[model samples]
Target: MTDTGQPSTAIARAQDSTALACQRMGDGYPLVLLAGQANNHHWWDRVRADFHATHSTITFDMRGTGGSGKPQGPYSTKQFADDVVAVLDHLSIERADVYGTSMGGRVAQWVAARHPARVRRLVLGCTSPGGPHAVERDASVRRALAQADPEAARRALTDLMYTPAWLADHPGPYTTLGDPDMPAHARHGHLVASNGHDAWDALQGITAPTLLLHGDQDRLTPPDNLPLLAARIPRTTSHVFPGARHAYFEECRAEASALVSAFLDEGP
Candidate 1:
């Protein structure tokens, strides 16, 4: 068992020889946390400790981000899901509960659907199923995402992620927009993978119990997609954080963590 207080890091090799940076801490059943688009393991830093008391939390940098290999583009969510399984395989963990937010949530959908036996439960936050059935973000938000000025883009993302009150109370750098030094190709790859995601048909194949979470005021992924997911995935429970936004998991950390822990602890 890894030391609960400090995380141990390692590299998991993907099928294409790409190296995925992984971290493990805590003890008990495994819980793998997937970061959003362009994000790395640090995405879960705030709430990771909450699961440590009962779960051996595993976090990793997906290909093209953080310490992971930044290979050539055309990355797909399915490929991202496969990379997640590769981490589990490296750790010798046959099955684990998955919690993914935003783009990570989209990847989780593929993970549960394509590798049913490997996932014990699924938690999706502020993500869409993609394709025609999924709701699109507002044009203004899309324009913000496409901004050429990095500072402008970051500011827009920060606004979309957290409310003003929360920002005032907890003023510190957040990884909502991901690494500032990310390679151009990797950034483009992540965008392509996220925008190209389509798991509408695949969601029905997921056998694990699932939980859908969203913020009522979310403008990035939008809350409208939550019910669409709940409708498709079997054995699903959902919650909408009343005044939260894109990063509801962080905005309502205590409550969200409790809901996740309880759901994952339930009998299979």
Candidate 2:
């Protein structure tokens, strides 16, 4: 551990030769935090302490995001999932719980399904299976995520993330927590990968214990996903945060943290 008690950072080379930026910290059983679409390890900057206090937590920038190498091409959730296993192998973490949000949740699905031995448990928030059963929000809102202007994209996403009442009150830097920098090319890759992701058929293959958290009011990938996920995964638990929106984890910070921390601490 560093002087600040934060995890030491490093880089791990993936199978495709792309360098993945990572942080492996805390103590006890490992827990990896996977950020949503276009977001990076920094997504956990505010909440890292919650998980790290109990588990040997790990967070990393997915390919084409943050400090990770950006190869120009359409990426797939399977490739992203493989990148995660590569990170575990690099850090020598044979088995660990995986928590992923939004698009990261989709990636987590692939991880637990394809490499069942590597993942001990799975936690998914604000995610979807991305096929015929999935529901989509407004097209303009989706378009805003990849808007060329950072400020514009952030503003658009901010409106969609938190509830109107919450936004009216907590007006400050906290708003920027969910918005990470995403270059145009990187945004393209993320959109392509996430848009093409379809884990409807793969959900039943997940053998690990699972938790699905969703916001009842989420416009991006609403509470409907929770039931879909629960019905499919054999061993699944779910919680729906009432009145919370897309960023319910942030909107209901303390509650979300406490619930997640407890789940991670409990043995599989």
Candidate 3:
């Protein structure tokens, strides 16, 4: 562990030759934490320690972000799922519990669907099950995201991700905003992959007991997607953090982490 007690990092190579940066720490049942689009392993920094006593937590940087390779794209969430499997394979971890947020949650759907045996349990937070059936964010939110200036776009997203009161109290170097220096092509790839995700059919194939979590006030992914997921996945439980926004896991870390721990501890 690092001085802050966070895990030590390592690298894993994907089939496509993408170098994935990953971290492993703690002990017991392995647990993988997946970050949203553009964000990296650091996205879970605040809450990772919460799971150390109960799980051997794993985290990694997705392609195009953090220490991972930023290859050209037309990237797909399916490909991202494959990359995740590659990381696990590298570590010789055949199966693990997965917790993902935003785009990472979308990727987790594919992981559980396509490689059912590799996931023992799944947690999806502030995410969507895209395609025609999925409820979308308002047009105004989309418009704000389309801002020409990157800083302005980040600002707009920050507002939507956290409640005003939370921001007032917590000073940031917010890891959730993702890599500012990511190449333009890679950033576009993440957007295309995330926006194009469609998991309605895949959700049914997941063999793991799934947990759907969201913030009631979330505008980015919207709380409506939670029930949609719960209805589709074979075994599911859901919770919506009252008055919270997209980053509810962080905003309500103690409660959220405890809830997650309880669920993962359940017997098959």
Candidate 4:
């Protein structure tokens, strides 16, 4: 784990040095927020702040992104789950309310299914069930990302992320945020963690109380898959924000925070 000298952010002290680096925020019942594959811990600033008002929040840079080590990887979602376990062990947290988005959601599913005792609750946002069509990017969009032109892809990706109305009024927020000083690891690891994953049939094994958050205008992970996820997980709740898009959490922070806060507050 590495320290960035940020006041509110504490460097994650991993038990296993080989796992991804991480950071912790706030101080209460630990709530770990795993970022989307290509993104870093900063992605959860709003969400973390929202929870910090009532609960401790842990946000981590996953392996190969942000402050985390990027070992050569054809990384699997299971491996990403293992990375989460490493963070918990690092913090000496027995169990946590885990939250994830997109590729992060896939990792959360793997963790909940395979490491049931490690997770007290699970929250999935703008994610899919890992099927052929559940979360496929169009070839043109994929091409842009694959070519390493995040700036080019930002426009289309951001469009896919927020509702059109929000997009029109708030283009700068996403455009600026997407321009993270992303390392090469972010690009490569994202391709591996996202496109390489296929875990639809594996979801039934997950037993934690789950909340699936989707946006009606989401193109990355369609809202239709919300029910599929809710049905597959034994005990699950779902919320679909009308006219919202993939980045609904960032775009509609207040509403999104309320939904997640209420769900996490519920008994397991």
Residue lDDT tens for model 3, 61-100: 8999888999997799999999999999999999999999
Model 1 segments beyond 4 Å from truth? Answer: 2-4
TM-score for candidate 4, residues paired by index: 0.87
Taking every candidate in turn, the Cα RMSD to the unseen true structure, in Å, is 1.0, 2.2, 1.5, 3.6
Tell me how candidate 4 scores on lDDT.
0.74
Q: lDDT by residue for model 2 over 153-243, one digit each (tens)?
A: 7777787788879888878566234435667788788888988888989899999989899999888886787898898888988899999
TM-scores for all candidates? 0.98, 0.92, 0.96, 0.87
Task: Identify the leading candidate in terms of TM-score.
Answer: 1
TM-score of 2: 0.92
Distance from true location, Cα of 119 in model 2, Å: 1.1
Count of backbone clashes for each model? Answer: 0, 0, 0, 0
Model 4 clashing residue pairs (backbone): none
Cand. 3 TM to true fold: 0.96
* Model 1 TM: 0.98
Winner by TM-score between candidate 3 and candidate 1: 1
lDDT comparison, 2 vs 3, better candidate: 3
Off by over 4 Å in 4: 1-16, 133-135, 143-150, 167-186
On the 0 to 100 scale, the lDDT of residue 79 in model 1 is: 98
